[model samples]
Target: PLGMVMGSCVYHIAHQRMGAKIGNIGRNVEIEQFTQALYDARELAMSRMQAEAEALHAEGIVGVQLRQHSHTWGSHTTEFFAIGTAVRPLRDNHIIERPTMVLSLDS
Candidate 1:
């Protein structure tokens, strides 16, 4: 069976901070809370994904993809998702063939 794993996290900005940002119209302001939330969510998602791979006794994970979604929870809420496929060593001193491209001298 293919060892596929995934992790998810949900985050929301504080109502007070949202209201404050709404009051500011044209001014360029950086919302630290929102930024922190994004960082935290991403870290949590990655850690959870790694934990899942560990549970599967996998040596490593490949093809990792991270995604975010707002859904119907409005603009203040966001969800972070991480997905990857876990893999293990096939055999001792085994070489895997990979596709390669060679330049043609005729060109």
Candidate 2:
């Protein structure tokens, strides 16, 4: 249930911009309309990434990188490219989430 393999040490770029020119789309379209398009695309890509990770039997992805194509150079197609090191944590203690705390009381 997988396709071509991926590699490591990838150069990443992340963007959250979608330009819907007037007349191209509804000029009266709310800002979220364009944003939603970008979000949906990202979610789809992430879905693919998740599948890739699952297919490889990786517990999680490390060094996850994001590449976004936001700029419209007369092109309508946009994509999200994510690359990372897929790994499976130790079975016994797999939960490795780090917690950040602001331990400060300002008066």
Candidate 3:
């Protein structure tokens, strides 16, 4: 049996104070703070999802997926969602069966 689990986090990026000074200037630079915020949000969502799986006594989560979305909250705001399927072994010595493939020949 498998259980679906999900976690979400909403984040807002702070406007750079130096952005005003650099306006109208043609220059390429890295926005470190914003990048860090994005990483943090993703980690937070994943952590929450793991916590939920732990509460359910699942051995581990499989097929984890992370998603990002922007809605009407504001231009600077974004949401990070993490989802996965929680699975547990039925017995202490459970063995995973190997998948078999069948080839069909038709001309």
The C-alpha RMSD in Å for every predicted model, in order, reads: 6.2, 8.4, 6.4
TM-score of 3: 0.78
Model 3 stretches with alpha carbons more than 4 Å out = 19-24, 95-107
| Model 1 C-alpha lDDT per residue in residues 17-84, reported as the tens digit of each score | 56686777788877777888889989989899999999998777788899998878577888899999
The number of the candidate with the highest TM-score is: 3
Error of 3 at 41 (Å): 0.3
Instruction: Name the candidate, 1 or 3, with the larger lDDT value.
Output: 3
lDDT of each: 0.82, 0.59, 0.85
Against the hidden reference, what TM-scores do the models get?
A: 0.74, 0.55, 0.78
What is the RMSD, in Å, between candidate 2 and the native fold over all Cα?
Answer: 8.4
What is the per-residue lDDT of model 2 for residues 17-102, given as tens digits with 9 covering 90 to 100?
A: 55545344644555565566667777766667777788888766766666776446535456677666667666677675753568
User: For model 3, which pairs clash?
Assistant: none
Which pairs clash inside model 2? none
Q: Candidate 3: deviation at residue 20, Å?
A: 6.2
Superior candidate under TM-score, 2 versus 3: 3
What's model 2's TM-score? 0.55
The lowest-lDDT stretch of 10 consecutive residues in candidate 1 is 92-101
Q: Could you tell me the lDDT of residue 28 within candidate 1?
A: 80
